[model samples]
Target: MVRSTNSAVRQDAAPAVSERQQSRVAKRAAAAKPAVKSEPIELPQDIDSSTAFQLIAASIFRQVGANEGAVRSANPQGVHQMRIGLRRMRAAISVFAQLVDDPETTRLKQELRWLTGRLGPARDLHLLALRLRRARGAAPERQKRLQVVETMRNEALATAIAALATDRYRKLQTDVWAWIEAGDWLGGAARRQVPRRARDFADAVLAKRARKIARRARELEALDVEGRHQLRIAAKKLYYAMGFFESLYDGRKSRERMADYQRKVKELLDHLGALNDLAVQQQLTGSLTPVVRQSDGLAVIAPSRHERTKTERLLKSAGRAGRELADAKSFWD
Candidate 1:
């Protein structure tokens, strides 16, 4: 997505919540029964599918902007907020796609996937760096070295930021904005052509990738190590597809089974993600070390031998998870 001109206005201006407020909110949420919060403004019962979808799409865009702002501003809470926004946007798309019959929904999903993928590495690195920083004070000599490592990490982060802020990201963002503004999500089929049978929508969506994934899951069981890795990618795409539409199906047994499948895919994805992160950090840290120690550059590259070891372990752990995802009995089960 292109960066908005009103970046400041794009973000919510609310002050940061204190720990006390967070505790209270958590308590309230935990004490409540599961319920969907009603929107402040009620949507008309007779509203057209296209209209309803446009409203949801607008919300999705706004949320995406907020997340992007979080990333650009280097705010941790903003980052969390952005991740939540992405999840909610995904959920909303999955739920409402039932009402509106459009292939563009799939296209938008692909766009979301792209946007989220770009942010994923940056978020992971930031989280890992924060974790490492918290542990640094306990080891004095190590602390000094870790601080050096952190300086290099910051430089690497800046590079990621520069990439995100470039024209490419902006162009994508602008294209998405144009779509939302013009309601391109309501493509091809007219609103009047859509039937009232929600089941039809669910069927269309469920059938989207269900058969292929099931076959792939079976194939995954018989593949060699590399083949299994390939299979896991298919599994993840299908899992995300399922996750997108899980809200529409409430059949007790099926829902439970789908949830299980989603969890398995998520586990595997997390593993792949960790492996990716470690590789990035290792490559980045290695590159920055020479640059930072040079006579004319920022003096930051100071990763300790131990920190490098941690990166290796992270990579190894990811490899194991990838293998498990590929080799597990009943990749679907």
Candidate 2:
């Protein structure tokens, strides 16, 4: 009986376009723009929780290796790619954490967080440096104006790279891998069952994600920037949890709602992501231009500054959207 702010609009909502129609539209778009394809992954019909967990953990471990390699080589593209891999792996954990229930999963997730924090500054600098380098390529004369920018970029990149190489970062990665190979995830905790096994599992998992999303939505509504970011993280997990059990919860309209929530979550996350980038950039700028703060130097990087503003607006918009989604009774039921 929760009333949405846009209750009237939602109550009188038009009949949804069929899922078939949705698929056709996507098909047409893909045909117009060819897309990348990885081999289809098939989830097993009957899986022991431990094996299922290992599969996901293995994927994450591979991503860590890849990202760590990029951090070492200072490859911007590699770092970006690895961040994506880490995201997917993180999503996988949220989706299947119950299956992989362990004393260590919490510990491992914390470790992953630390790794993300360590790499964040470096990744931002790498992205900024790459963007500037690409722009510099378009106009040769621009180099004179960019020398200070380049020096700043180099200093930031070096600091990030050095941080990545530290013993702490290395140990963090090691601990993650060790957790994966630990093989004692469940600690032999026995699971009781509801009459419907798969269905019950699906319901429980979805319910857990819903509760998290609701908590996050409330935080966001309170205008807590950090809280909003935290909520986005929860929403991403919820999005992927529904996806992992797609076959079990194959309702067309419900799937659409999940996708909608995912989009909103990403939109919000992008805002915080931009702010984080600016923080790193500001640090780099301060370090590289210690002597004289030139107006031109700041002007040259004005576009990134504008993007920061744009992302802040998106965060607010996304917060409203999240509140709407969270208040929907159907979203929880």
Candidate 3:
């Protein structure tokens, strides 16, 4: 799949989203390679695939700009939001792979991974630190241990800042713009094919993807740590794909129905995300700090046996949500 939104579009009516979408069309197109495979879905006479790709990619990319300040300020929400934006863009590229398959596209995706990795650790540590700090404890020795965790978090954030300031990050953004606006897709052999209408493409692809979710959901209760991890990842990928294609669906009711489905998907993702974070923090703090403070024997505030019950509850919720999504109708229908 040339990251899946693989078709063409004309810039007739100017919407704010279109303007933003067009903004990333890179002026420096000196580095693109020859024909790549993309989603290659047949475009209907009424729907332009290229325009749809632009809008989808642009919406995902735009959030990065607003999120920068928040990440810089060490706000966990900022880092979290930026990570979401990057993940969505990656999925968009996957969803529209055929239409925009350049070496630069690969490079940009790698950079996104690198950048998100940097942000991920700092965000995780920040969250863990905050949780540790808020636990009711008045002992001076406990305060000192908290301070050590805080120091570790600050060091991680510094590393993230360095990654953000690098030239590669800027270059990735530039490359993404170039890929989005590059008219190379219009001139490809793909342009010769009568692609399916955007609506039809959405319906087909979404239904196929939903079936995967349903299959995964069937064994959610039986999944081990790694199995559950894979399920969470699949859910996220489907979530991003649905978001980009939602615009292809007609009628206010259809849009609302999709929106409702998206929310359910998100709820599952959040529960899984929280569970993952709890796992990470437990592993991280266990390795990074002394279980018992050397000076006063103050123990770490890691997730307790009691927390296992909470994790189980979250898993149940996620499974239910995933099943609901799997059974839901394709919004494009």
> Considering every candidate listed, which one attains the maximal lDDT?
3
Give the worst 10-residue stretch by lDDT in candidate 2.
1-10
Candidates sorted by lDDT, best first: 3, 2, 1
Best by TM-score: 3
lDDT of each: 0.49, 0.53, 0.64
Off by over 4 Å in 2: 1-41, 45-48, 66-73, 87-114, 130-178, 189-199, 215-222, 240-248, 251-254, 271-312, 327-333
lDDT of 3 by residue, 216-272 (tens): 876676778788788888788888787666556657888788888888788878877
Against the hidden reference, what TM-scores do the models get? 0.51, 0.60, 0.76
Model 1 misplacement above 4 A: 1-59, 68-73, 80-125, 134-145, 148-178, 184-187, 190-239, 295-333
lDDT of 2 at 244: 53
Q: Which residue runs does candidate 3 get wrong by more than 4 Å?
A: 1-46, 139-142, 183-196, 290-303
Candidate 2, 1-333: lDDT as tens digits: 111212222222223434554344334323332212112223364544455556556655575565554445545445555555566667776666555556677776776665554444435544555555766255543453356444433343344355567787678677667766664654542462322244456567778778777666655646554565566566667655555554443467866766665566565556545544554455444443432344443332334555567656766766676676666554323
TM-score of 2: 0.60
- Assess candidate 3 and give its TM-score to the true structure: 0.76
